[model samples]
Target: MNKKGMAASLLTAVMLVSAGCGGSDTAGTGDKGGADSGSASGPKKVVFWHAMGGANTKVVDQLVADYNASQDKIKVEAVFQGSYDDLLSKLKASMGTKEGPSVVQMYEIGSRFMIDSKMVTPMQNFIDADKYDLTQLEPNITGYYTFNDKLFSMPFNTSNPVLYYNKDLFKAAGLDPEKPPATYEEFQKAAEAISKTGKATGGNFAIYGWFMEQFFANQGAEYINNGNGRKELATQSLVNSEAGVQTLTWWKNMVDSKAMNNLGRKTDDSKKAFSAGQVGMILDSTAALKGLVDSSKGKFEVGTGFLPKPANAKDGGVVVGGASLWIMNDRADDEQKATWDFIKFLTSPKEQAYWHINTGYFPITKKAYDEQSVKDNMKNFPQFQTAVDQLHQTKLNTATQGAVMGVFPEARQIVEGAIEEVLNNKKSPKDALDAAAKDISSKIEKYNKTVK
Candidate 1:
């Protein structure tokens, strides 16, 4: 055979060998690279992993299609992981290898976890390099992914817990649908009245409000030393603080008085109760907007409203609640570039505005709020606007950054168990929270050592 023919045969053998190895899976990441070392024509394929489900999932997939159609430079693929835990585990295991997708949607609390693994690219680097207007972003939401003044990730969806009421119940119970509870006292009274009436049961909500942290935030209390979660120093425990104790005590009282139920968090059963008119008021997540709206089955008009705070918490409002997005660093250079592009596209004003209107998540871009479509919807849909308005009311000091302890999930579970003890009369509020404080402090120390 000629020399050229021999080279062709040798190349085919190399291709077969590469395919059986794990190299072929790397391209499966959907990142693009061309024949030349300097290929920049755009990625031919990109893989995106997320845990979004149901009708909302469709919107995300459509958005991917829209991005793909906008240019021939990129082709995107979407894969749905069952839950956040599943996605986190999968991503971690695939790190340093090519089995992972180029882009993944991660939650706000997971931001640090992702960063600690050193598998994530600080998204702010990409933003700066591209000269994107970082200031064009809302300052409040940006804090979620910030660490030591550097932004490590892009926030995707932010969900805060709000008050959702049964409009007909509100009216029938002699309460004005327009005038919802503005303070914890008002909330208690109103919940009590609604419970006694046929509108709702007195104990609709339980020991813990939806989200669990609102009582502290609404009361203008600093949950910890730094809400931003910079805990390199020996962080003090705020749950033992005056505001923390006050909130937990009040919650205990609320449950004991039967104004709110001592039941568990929002579950499928809880949603059913609230939807079926068994519960008059619920402090639930904004993401549940789609769920509640759909489950109502047109039986009643679902009225959404801002969360009520304590009278003492008057003047300023609370910061946002819920999740955000982060990008993983364990991928090829081409994949990181592709993921960054997708992140920008997803957070663009048009997408933000649409997502805000459709889902319960808040938009991180001020421009999204400026859109005529968003404005029109706000006038038509007060729920979306209420959250935006509250976002500006957020406090910006270290106290406002929110929590970042590794055992946070474990800490939250401790809080849950303690709250349950209080409701069941198994322990006093002081004892319950005190026990949680001790447990959390210990866990925080252990996690700190690991990081240290």
Candidate 2:
């Protein structure tokens, strides 16, 4: 069963569910231009559910308001649906019913599940229908959402992991403040140097599964077989591979050396430790660049660097990390089209610029880089350039494109547990990863069978 090859037929299944089981297309407007003229009561409504929180939520609300103000045919009502996991669970519960949102935002790992569920329209259809120019968008970002040569969702908030270091601490440790570590060996030495300063610990990486995946990609290692699941459904997890074991071994060594602290699994906790000057460096998403800079404004100068790789690694790149917009197919044609229009407005160069500056996410549209605001932002926060450079430098390979599995979220949890076990000295890196890989492979096998 080739998953990507099933898209066209599954697209029809999605539409049938929308028109037959869900609702009829009452609005006559077929094109993307405008919706039907509503009665004197009000405009047609398009419901949108998302998982953006904190400062990002405000930005989302403002964007939604801007879109509504820009048009009168359709009124887009935005609803915050908690975290990404929560939003996905809610969408699952709302499937086949009118209660689901016309548009929803889902995390990157949910791509396989979304495609398999057949509950949403392929963004490719809208692109083909409207002659949308996808070339205008960032290819690295779009590559993640593209499956079976078709884009299933609109790449919205995109990001990658980077190393954040405290320059003040670096200088205090008699290290060059301008040069951040680029390899695991260099990272260990720098961590030891920073710790020797007695002012802050060397570094701390949250026991995060995403970081594990990134490290595997950093070494040009596939996280799963079958071209990281892009070529076909993945039946196994390669978390026990040499790259995976090397990553865990390096991480466990750092913790054992007391150069880096094991701060549990919460990225926020690790971020706070860095902000409070308790840790000199940390690994975090590019989307946190803005908040981290603000938190360390008066305390220390923050510097960014590419995610560390093994010293021997010759080829690898960071995978795109973030969420994308999905259009629920179980909605009226007018509402779905309206959702498309809103997505277009959001992804436009201008909006992407605003989003990039405000949220610290990569502007999915390339033209956004030409925006004056973006140029000024680049100048003000030069550390952001590291992420942009890393993204651009990435090669379009399966490892960099990232792995796709319906059980990705669960797999991440399993990997995190393995990390915890190794860091706690309860299990060897190979032993722990072997167990985690076995568990994830079992889940993958189950998922593939169920989907088939």
Per-model lDDT = 0.64, 0.83
Q: List the candidate 2 regions with Cα displacement exceeding 4 Å.
A: 1-42
Model 2 whole-model lDDT (C-alpha atoms): 0.83
**In candidate 2, what are the lDDT values of residues 29-55, reduced to their tens digit?**
111212232455777787777777666
lDDT per residue as tens, model 1, 169-239: 77777888878787767777877787768556643554342245566666656555555367453354566
Full-model lDDT, candidate 1: 0.64
Weakest 10 consecutive residues of candidate 2 by summed lDDT = 15-24
